[model samples]
Target: MNIIVTRPKEDGSPLKEKLETMGHRVILMPLLRIVPRPRAFIRKLPYQAIVITSANGIRALSGHTELKSIRMLTVGPQSMKAAKEAGFLKVEAHGDLVGLATHIRKTLNLTAGP
Candidate 1:
């Protein structure tokens, strides 16, 4: 089978390797680039928890001093691992966005608001 992975080089390389090992032709054509923004102060606000859908978000916030202090709710195992590696002490993982929202709604009882 032929596969074209549009993810960035850093992300697609491993997948390409794995696919090739499985006898698949993989093409690397990165569709997006990850650019880390300059560090900024995360305002101290009264919020129940922080929700992250991607590992990139965790990477973006990794340098922040406040990352370890907040409770993190993330979608998927990779995002959970990234959050933990980024020094997030309290982290929860869900299968997808819907699951994350359900967990938040049931456990945190938060329908809306910051």
Candidate 2:
């Protein structure tokens, strides 16, 4: 069997190696590349909450102590996990962006800083 894995390199490499061991040829062609922001470039700003769509976003905010005190909204389980691991006390996970937006509108007061 020949398999084409279009996931990112960090995600597809493990599956590719596993399939090769199982007698299948695997092509690890990542469909998108993740360009990480410089660590020093990101700092805590005046915001009520931070919305993170991916685990990478949590990773990018690592080492910023000021972010731990704010609310963290994650798009999925993976992002939620990352936010938790990063020591965010207030973390909420939504299934998708639409749901996240709905949750935000329902629970968050717009008068507060966003």
Candidate 3:
């Protein structure tokens, strides 16, 4: 099958090898790029938790002292995997944003307009 792997180019390379080994043709079209935040920039946030939807977010936040204390809510298995690999210990797998938002609303006990 002609499979299109849309992960970032660097990450996509590994998947491509695995897919090729499985006899599937892989196309690498990265839909996003990961740019890390400056180390100095991380010193300014007062966040309680980190919300990450992409693996790029994991790469961006890696090795920052500020994030060490913040819990993480990540979308899908891949992002969760990346976040964990990037040293996040307190991570929540939220599946997708819509589901995450629903979970957040419930967890926070937020109600819709009356």
Candidate 4:
């Protein structure tokens, strides 16, 4: 079967390869382009934990090895894997925004520091 993947190049390329391995014809038609902001501009805030929703966030936070000590909550498996690869000691994976919010509320002391 022929499949058209419309994800970004970074994400679509992997899916294309996987499909080819499965003997499916995958045409990668990347519709989105990621323009990463300056990594230096990203700084750690005074928060108890860090919440990341995208794998790109990991790339953006590159070189901040000290941040690996902070607890991290990611939106999906990909984000979780990225966090782990980035050497985050404490990482939680959630499926969606609501789940992530619930986890934060249950785990974090909201009345405390930001």
Instruction: Tell me, by TM-score, which candidate is best.
Output: 1
Structure candidate 1, residue pairs in collision: none
TM-score each candidate.
0.85, 0.72, 0.71, 0.79
Off by over 4 Å in 1: 111-113
Collision pairs in model 2: none
Candidate 3, poorest ten consecutive residues by summed lDDT: 105-114
Cα-lDDT of candidate 1: 0.86
| Per-residue lDDT over 1-114 for candidate 2, one digit per residue giving the tens place of the 0 to 100 score | 999999779767877998999999899999988877666655446787888987767877877877787888889787788789889888999899999999889988888766
Residue pairs clashing, model 3 = none
Candidate RMSDs in Å, in order, are 1.9, 3.6, 4.2, 2.3
Candidates 2 and 4 compared: the better one by TM-score is: 4
For all candidates in order, the CA lDDT equals 0.86, 0.83, 0.78, 0.85
Best candidate according to lDDT: 1
Candidate 1, residue 23: lDDT: 99
Predicted candidate 1 versus true structure: per-residue lDDT over 1-114, tens digit per residue: 999999888778978999999999999999999998899777877668889988778888888866577888999888898788889899989899999989988878465545
* Candidate 4 lDDT over residue span 1-114, tens digit each: 999999888888988999999999999998888887665744657778989988778777756787888888998888898889888888889898899999998988999876
Q: Report how far residue 35 has shifted in candidate 3, in Å.
A: 3.7
Q: Which 10-residue window of candidate 2 scores lowest in summed lDDT?
A: 36-45
Name the better of 1 and 4 by TM-score: 1
